[model samples]
Target: MASVQHPFPPLLSQDSADIERWLLALNDVYASDEVALIRKACEFAAPLYHDEVDVTGASLLQHALGSASILIGLHMDHETIAATALHAVPNHLQDWREVLTTRFGANVTRLVAGISDMERLRHFSELREAAIADKQEAAQQVEGLRKMLLAMVEDIRVVLIKLAERTQTLRNLSSASPDTQQHIAQETRSIFGPLANRLGVWQLKWELEDLSLRYLEPLLYKKVAKLLDERRVDREKYIADIVAQLQSALAAQGIKGEVNGRPKHIHSIINKMKRKQMEFSELYDIRAVRVQVKDVENCYAALSVVHELWPAIHSEFDDYIANPKPNGYQSLHTAVLGPRDLAVEVQIRTPQMHHDSELGVAAHWRYKENKQSESGFDEKIAWLRQILAWKAELADSGEMKEQFKNELLQDRVYVFTPQGKVIDLPKGATPVDFAYVVHTDLGHRTRGAKLDGSIAPLNTKLQTGQRVEILTAKQGGPSRDWLSPKLGFLQSARSRAKVRHWFSEQNVDDSIAQGRALLDRELVRVGVTDINQEKLAQKLKFNKLDDLLASLGRGEITPRRVSLAIGQEAPVNAPRASTQTIATSDGNVVIEGVGNLVSRTAKCCSPTKGDEIIGYVTRDRGITIHRRDCPFMQRVPEEREDRLLEARWVAKTN
Candidate 1:
């Protein structure tokens, strides 16, 4: 594929001042070696992307620097920042992967590869001919895209890198054509913003939503920004005064907490206005203060101090700490009558709750999406964030590489279907597993598969971004070999179960034949000759000969049971009596009939060795033992009632 060249001016083009500023911002967060790695990446990528520009006519080198700066702001690792710098290299330079791997080690190479995988998503997202007009369809499409984006990458850092890249594009939207800006803004608003929100990346989410709003709804964004700016000084002073009073009161009361003015962004204010159908004057939270304390008790205590200091609006009080939002977000919200009869909002929360609200799943819009539970993907993101947090705490540790390897996504590989739909599976998943993930019916009919348009083995393990096409029979089921571990055809347990279930529900006649063949083979292996099939079936509590054989084929019954049943290998503590009171293995049941009428417990009910069992005389079959409450026994025809007989356990001779 030809390299896609950006046609815009670079934000950092020929600007050593901008590049040095970027490096300076990293000084606080990154160590010497980490900073060196980032600088090396920039130095390496500058020549490659120097001639290229982004859609906004910004230099690709400048765009890369801008994105890396964003990751640095997010406190991302050096590898993430480095990868952001070279994200476009693989597309622009031939043999970029090999060079990157050789120079930066496997971790940076992996990060670059992840970025490359996400570039396809960017193209996929941006190729829409026009903005979707239908509100519902647009929402659903964006929602699906969000899921696909999250499902596409192995490293959550890749997602952060993507977000940073999008943020840079939005920031530099001025130079882009109106059409390109609109497309990019729409994608950012509908796709990237929600994703950042879901991942609890507040800084990225806010900038994305704000920038997208600025482009897409220029007039409204200006209106909100103008209104906020008009009273910005007054509001800041008022909030500062209130925070001062609260701080003094808390200090006097021996409380430890932080009280800060909450500056609501333009996009958020506009969204709140639209969502609540409220006038700007009615929004009390426009000038708000958030109190973050050390613990739950401190949160409540701080709330009391605020309420005591000011009279709260009766209907504006919410005790979220007592009743957290569905997504596990907790905070105390109260709107109060402040100095000069002005309305102000106060939010009191523990530091942890505040962290979760900002950077955890219980992000800014906690009530908007009340998901029942966080998905595995969401959990992985949370884990990645935890790792980032630990990196901050363990900044001096030398074991970061080993720790990263241990914590990185190790089991799951996210791949794309030929049409760009993401299918997540275990690391070693094959096309068959991919088919199963798509649909069980597709898996059942999967006859062959192609990996990246070339025929590959059914068991060929998939890698990230590999397009898989499953060739299926018009009418067929999954082969039994797919369920066999020795065949190496399937790695997914769900796929194996589906294949097993299909075989289990197969036509009884075929199952019986297969079962019979399996039993004969096992019997031959066990050196049991001329075994009474009917007696064996009864002893196993199978009502019919076919049922017993089918059970064997389905692997519900092990072959060792056959050897034990035929007395070729006596079970532990077997009763030795063999006359009128002949004892079955385990002394669970005594034969009620004469001359070796095979009596065995039924599999359907799984009657234990000592459980009471009744014998049912099956035609051309020996007495089949069943628990009294067995479903088959209760449903037996009235004519077969005579076949039912009393059976009891035999007392073993010590």
Candidate 2:
């Protein structure tokens, strides 16, 4: 590979110096062969990136080196660091895949490819905030793009590498144009910072958020920084005194621990002020210290000694060791008044917990490596995804933390629109569902669809990373076939409801005309015509003749059911059964063979007195009554068939 000639010369002395520095920095963590591999990758990438500058006007080779350095700080594996060094190779070389594979190995090649794939998402990020009209929709689309970024990569390291590259870009963002700076900062604050937070990369999360804030809100950032700077000397002196006292106290108690002052970032400071509506001086954590011990017991011992040394604020204490966070973060947090009656915060945790706190999911790579089972890795990924889903709620309530314990990780499929917007759907979502999610009008007018530039069936199950283009008509409604579960035209219940609503909203005259024609045919088939339609409608519990016809036209009522009601002699107000009746609060539904059971109508299919219904036994809720032909009921798995029971309408007794 070294023998192959290119436009660029061999590594210069300066380039060699940079490579040596990188290797030296990584020497403690990486083996000799691993260090040599990183050196080779850096050498290979340096030439391809020669004379190349990124959008920030920084040397591409320097950018790659900066990114690798960040990964090294995370203690990422050699493969990840090497891949970061060569991440931009695909943009520089056409045959980069084969070259990387041949020189480094298939792992490096895959990592580089994953990086390239993620880079394509940068285009969406640039346009997301500006192109979207509705703020909520734009926020949702941004979330979709985040999930798409994760779905695009098979390896989690790819995401970490991408995060590192973004951080490097932000660090160099000062040299870029104002528009470019604002764009990059906004994207980072909205996407990458939250991503790092979710992945438990506190080291990168704090920096990314702080840098983005510096660019996005320069005035506020400077204000907070100025405040911290003004107090830096006195704060440092005070923290140093507290650290010494805590260290001596811990030593006297036979507790071994490392205590250090914790630095507070500007963005978090501003956030704390805004969230709690407090002045910076009132914040207890501004002057904070963290203690790292050897074991869980030492952690408690250190905490006890700290409290003994200072007056502890009862409300400010949190015992997270007994209750770890959803992301597996464990530490004891407390706020107290130190010497001079100054407020101080303290955090106590084991060294392993400290390592995990700093590196987050990145620490898993160091220990689990090849030993982690696929299922276990998937659980971690699921936790990250859940964090992404409930990020906003997680900040406000401890109850939301308990909600995270229940794994609600459903399989999701992410696809792109014609204009590069991401749309997330369920595992088996179809084009009609996609169309409805985008816009109900678009879904109603959808005549066909094309997947990846090729015309496909409307019922085609979408996959992640596919580009979907819905082919719509000028004016039309969805086909009734979409509501049929067996046809698989629509997979989402929301989409099916939209289709039903469209039919339900049709012109009353037209619906009655269509229904009358169908009913006349059914009557001819049964060889009966003199039947009074008004009495028949009354027997069916419809207020008027047109209501019955409209229900028939909407497919909510079948013609054979009209024929069945014709032979019955009971009046509309007749009361029939006194058998076991399990009525709801409104006394509408009666579950057969069951009594004294609470029941409620299912929101998915609100069954009325005249509609055919069934009962489903729920875990907590006694029983849920659903329409017999509800799409949700039809989709219930065979394993849950035992939950199904017979239910019917009991005539009202006045």
Candidate 3:
């Protein structure tokens, strides 16, 4: 296949070369049909984005190609590659979805949509200084932010595409301003680099780290780069010579193995120096070669060959394969005296181990991104990797889409406070829930909210990466209406519980005042007036008036019973009798001074048989019974205590 030249602008013209090079690269890695789909997508996108430019002032078409190139290097599937090509086109063309579906089919369209959604992470880009200034907290927050990104996308491939795009952006970052470079570099280091690392995309992960280091510490980067370049050719020659000798020895020993020099990147070298507080001369791995064999046995055999070829440094040998790291990294490492007494490190492992070390279980990114594994985010990434491994066999488009929907990125939404601190919440959580999640005091005082600088309803469901600002009163508690499910003001159960607890702790005076207001409202609704308070309170078993009012305020007693007990006409079809007294239910009660005046029990306090009971003569509906110590009875006025009637349960009544 002929190499396809970079397709320059004046796009959609006849002279543009076909992207056969990219297609050929995908041929062996993907099914013929999947490869064809990717070609169709690339051809469709090339013309549409040809005239565009990206944030770094590069051709948007070239940027897309660069991003697709990164995914291809990861050996990603057709959907990911195709989506990378088309992720930017929708921004330029109207009805892009219809166009995508008509040309590349629905699967590609869906992939494009997922990629688009994942790309919208600008709020994370603007985190407050407080969030990142503290090392430990920043690491935790960054880990959470990575999980948030992973959890936000419907398909794991969307994140893969995003990482690819970020890699390309950083690759061409020199075209951007110093400010843009620093900003982009910081974002990659804090978020995308670690994300790539966790996903085991070692190729992108290392480059991201190296590039970020380049921009973040320019002087150190230049110094190290200059030093490495000074003897680059000599180092390469020496490494090549060592690899040749190792490869020849392994073959002669009937051991099939691959040997290569592991160039110590500037960033990694500097990190080790600073971390270990060592001088450049003290670094044994400055010159290193890795040997990858077929199995564990072959790994030891290869290590023997390396030892026989050079004198091993006793202090530098580590048999990690026998005792793996906590994250499951496996290898045999040793430093040896090489040609001219130069120190060179050798790492021996199986090919599988090597791959794992690069982008598998042993990759450094996995441990960094998931040091705190309480969230099981590491397991999610592992599952995603498993899914990607079978991408070629995932022939059922509908099933794949459903799997994408059912799993990955659905549990938590990462939103931002106005101060830029990230606040994580369950999906479909409301702004009031967000307020409560931030602080209990904030939740209690939360009266209004501002979402993205616009005043929003308290119940508005928060989306990932939306900036939220809660408007609170100087002092107040949550409304009782917030506890009402039908009102839909709050969604978080924690917030609801907090509100309930606040109300439960309210002062008795306040409860009584509120309870009185509710009782007055109920009286007006029932048209009851001039009631004998003492008799009512005594009949209800309350020794104090305020106690009865407090119970009413707390909803321990319903207002309907107050009307019925006082002999006011009940609401139409309302229950005419209260169940508070056993005598009313059994028709066995005797009220002194009231003879068969339509007796009933008060529902507020259900007085049982053998209990001390009292009664109040209603205006018309006979005497109502109550427990002697009921809170309602205490509300009765002393002057009106005459209306209190003695009632008892008759043992013989059936």
Each prediction's whole-model lDDT (CA)? 0.71, 0.79, 0.70
- Candidates 2 and 3 compared: the better one by TM-score is 2
Q: Rank the candidates by lDDT, best first.
A: 2, 1, 3
Tell me how far the alpha carbon of residue 191 in candidate 1 is from the true structure, in angstroms, after superposition.
3.8
lDDT per residue, candidate 1, 1-654, as tens digits? Answer: 011122222345547776776666666666778788888988898877767888998888888877876665454567777888889888777888889999888889998888887677656544331445677655554544454455556667787788889988887898899998887888787677866765666666777888888889999888878888898899999999999999999998999989998868777788879878998878888989999889988888888898899998978888878865333457999999999989999999888787676554323211112333336646645554332212122433557645544643445665656655556577789999999989999999999999878999998988755778999999988775675555568888787778778878888778778778877775665444565678778887888788888876664554544433544232335443332343556664654333466555677886656565666677756666677678997686433454665555666775
**Candidates by TM-score, descending order:** 2, 1, 3
TM-score of each candidate structure, all chains considered together: 0.67, 0.74, 0.64
Clashes of each: 10, 0, 21
- Weakest 10 consecutive residues of candidate 1 by summed lDDT: 1-10
TM-score of 1: 0.67
Write candidate 2's Cα lDDT for 349-415 as tens digits.
9989998888888877752335554577677866565434626547457666565555343477888
- Candidate 2 residue runs with Cα over 4 Å from true position: 1-14, 20-28, 93-104, 133-137, 367-378, 390-395, 398-410, 419-422, 506-553, 557-654
Give me the overall lDDT of model 3: 0.70
Residue 302 of model 3 has an lDDT of: 86
Relative to the unseen true structure, what is the C-alpha lDDT of residue 436 in candidate 3, on a scale of 0 to 100?
A: 88
* Stronger candidate by lDDT (2 vs 3): 2
